[model samples]
Target: MQIYDVCIIGAGPVGLSLAAALQKSKQLNKVLILDSIKKPKFNKQGLPNQRVLSVTQSSREVLQSVGAWDKLEQGRVNPYNRMIIDESNGQDYLEFKNQQAHIIEYDNIVNALLEVYDGEIEFESKLEKIELKPNEYVTVNDKFQCKLLIGSDGNKSKVKECSNIGTYGHSYHQMGIVCTVERTDQDSEVAYQTYLSNGCPLALLPLYNPYSSIVWTAYMDDYKYLMSLSDEEFLKVLNSQLGRYAPRIKSISNKRMAFPLQSLQAQRYIQKRIALIGDAAHSNHPMAGQGMNMGINDAALLANCIIKNSRSGNDIGLEQSLEEYESQAKLMNYTTSIAMELIKNTYENKTISPLRQLGAKIINNLDPIKQIMIQYGSKHPLGPSQFEWVK
Candidate 1:
């Protein structure tokens, strides 16, 4: 009987993140990461690296904790010192800056973490089944048992299914359409977004000085129409309405992508001794692009808690600890989901008033709100103390 201290059952950002996080754990030296894919080429071969993860300060600390931050590429990573969220009407806008928030290349961060943590990342090991033994040990793939099992698999986590954990939340009547565009005229390291009042998409996030990632969260039917447009026409339509604010049009670089915009959180992020992280536990609407960052935070928190418990000689990933993780995961995931809902409702619901938009405008202009938004959105803009996990 060969048992591991910890086993992660996913190779996405969340799973890799956990391996990265638990790499140097004194409590978990023997860890195995299993993924079903023979290789992580599922999206890599097609997607133009369409993702541009917005790394918060806490996320940076998380990467650093896992020995991956310094490995981030020098030039490929673009920093957004400032961001502006404006309405198509140009009347309402929210602005944040480096003193406000920051971001980085999505793939760069993931690959950096992988490069640093040269450990067991079994890409092709698809989890066919998982059974919790009478001893409460999770036996996965009929091969391994662990003191702990982490389902960082993703939104449709097989771990969650096998464990029979109930879920909550709704599939938003929206789809997040993502793409990359080249900027004709450039300015400071900044991002721009134009929120629509009548059920259109939300904002665009900056990827590079000359490029940005478009996260158009809109109705599926509407997005499908846009998707059918020729590349030039798509850029034209994107520019026609959102273009007036743009210096140049965009062309899909990464596999032109679109997925249903839904917010889902597992009813219990943990079951028995197994803990769920990232999309397995929570999938918030990406109106904010905070999903990856949030999962990174979860990895950091779980790692810290386990390490702390080990230092104090407590059971790592025990029932009590897993409960705490679930509680906190629910809170964080729910709070973020609601925030995204607020913005979504404001734009999607036709009954929303211009006064409501004004209220958003007023809120955005406030220094305290601005600071909190920047801090929260950027994951510890205030400093390390506020976000204790970063410490």
Candidate 2:
């Protein structure tokens, strides 16, 4: 019997972020956030979570505005001033010298959002069912009512499923292996990745001092072989594979986790009074570290749309209002998703890899092109108008 202006399902960083942003913007008076999982706990003793996020400048701005950035422990945030991507052959290298990104523990972002969030969150509240009446409010499990429903749940979202929203995407036949690792040299603030002949790109992303998070994307067989090794043997293989990429891994902490890679997008981002964001709306390969970034953008854009709609005295959940959000967000997500897919395909195709490498070399030498790419990767370096909303 409790009616809220907005109810967001899934309390992950993206979902919680939306709740916080809405409250901060004063766009909605009452918002409800529900998640199946309990609140994420910060690891006090062991290694940080294997999951890491590359916070772009724009995303950092969003977090800063909501007070989440300040909530993040300063020691755990690693700011990478440079990034380099190249082939194992040392050809086709691209480097960005500016402060390209920051690596933050996943839980840090969530806790930060939680710190600033003043709205209601129902932990362990799994969404059992969702009822949707076109052009009307949505009902959740016959208990909660909301003028608008937002699904920030992951790829297999209950809200998206209950709304009968179709999706499109394909698996990359790859698995991403993630683990925390230590390197001998920690002075460098650069993140590095090398594309291997096997079509997998192994990246070393810096964490707090001396520690880094490894995201090695590999084919199924390669992944299986890597997983079969002991910790010591795995470290050796990693070092040997890197060849000349110095500062080898001294040791790896925590167990490695592997996830299937895919690019998925909902056929439509909105359905009547219900809308989807984050992984619920689109899930992309992690090669670019843009999955969560895209989700963050979704939350921001949706908040802006709702604010505009409410100010205009129009129903916030109406298709017209939601369309304004979907049009821009869907296009941006699609463009980035397709670009990533093409890069993956180009690298995976061994026959054309040489040409691809040549092309990369060409682009690397072109200052204007490289600068543009770097700027775009940093989330619209040209200006805030292109991508950023909500100031």
Candidate 3:
């Protein structure tokens, strides 16, 4: 019969970050986080984790607000100042020169958030049941009750399922192959993404010196064939495919991993005393590397809403108070999702190859247009930013 002001499900980066943000407010004392799995450990001495996030400037600011940015191991954070985009035909290309994004290990981000968040965490506490008590509160597993129950548990969230929130989106029917590779020339801090003839994009994201991470998006059949190749054979194919676009690969530094790609968005972000964030609410194709960044924004905006409501002596879980969060977050997530889908479809269309190449050249030469696109890709907040609440 323990009651908390907020109970967040899932202990990934997004969940922990929400916990950290809530813990920053003195008015909200009873906050808890529950995760079904044990705490993840980040080995600083080991090879970089296959899973990495491209932290944009906006995401960096959110982490800084919660005091987690400084906790990240600086040595492992690789900031790429430039990004090169082109087609396999090499007819035209686009180059963006400025601080674009940072490639950091997923475990590194989780560990940093854990360090900054000093709230109650229940590990191995799988959610079995959730009972809604109308305007009163929501109870989980008949053990913990909270005025607001936030779901940060990822795409297959139990909280989302129990709340009966329906999601709508289509699968890309593609897989993203991720792995760490050694590069002969690592002095350059640049990210290269080239769309192949088959419309798949292979991105080489710079990591720590001498190493980089690759995210190769391919159709299901091509993915299966690539995964079947030996390490040496795969490297050969990769080098031959990149040609003059990417740095020469010296060796495969980590085991290759693949995951299905899809774009998902919950029907609604809030229901009564329940709310959803992160992958629980929406997930997008990784082509833009904005999935994690979008989730981080969700946690930030939700935490800000909850904090402001609490300070104003308002009910945190009430629909009115949570509505703004839902509206804003959904708008951002939806816009990004649509943009990614359009990019994916446009690149895969063979008839638009000439126009696409011409457009890339035109945009590359237009500084203002290119900057605007970069900001959009970074998910920079616009007009009366919600981040003000964090400060």
Error of 1 at 207 (Å): 2.3
lDDT of each: 0.70, 0.83, 0.87
Q: Each candidate's root-mean-square deviation in Å?
A: 3.1, 2.1, 1.5
Cα lDDT tens digits, model 3, 1-391, are 9999999999998888888888876669799899999888999999888998889888888888889999999899999889988888757898888856899999999999999988899889998889998879899999999999999999899999999999998788999999998898956489988899988899988899888889999899999999999999999988887736678899988789999988899999998888899899998889889888888888888887888899899999899999988998888888888888899888899998999988998988999988888888775554126554455
Task: Tell how far residue 137 is off in model 1, in angstroms.
Answer: 2.2
Candidate number with greatest TM-score: 3
Query: How would you encode candidate 1's per-residue C-alpha lDDT over 249-339 as one tens digit per residue?
Result: 5465645688776678887877666888888888877767788878876776677666666667766657775665666656766776778
TM-score of each: 0.89, 0.95, 0.97
> Runs in model 3 with CA error above 4 Å?
383-391
lDDT of 2 by residue, 1-391 (tens): 8999899999887898778878877757799999999877876455778999888887887788778899887788889988778777645577777856899989888988988897899989999998886666788989999999999999999999999899998887889999999888865488887888776888889887788889999889999999999999999999877635546889988799999988899999997788899999998889888888888888878877887787778888888889978988888888888788888778778888778878877887787887777677678422224322244
Give the Å shift of residue 260 in candidate 1. Answer: 1.8
Better of 2 and 3 by TM-score: 3
**By TM-score, how accurate is candidate 3?**
0.97
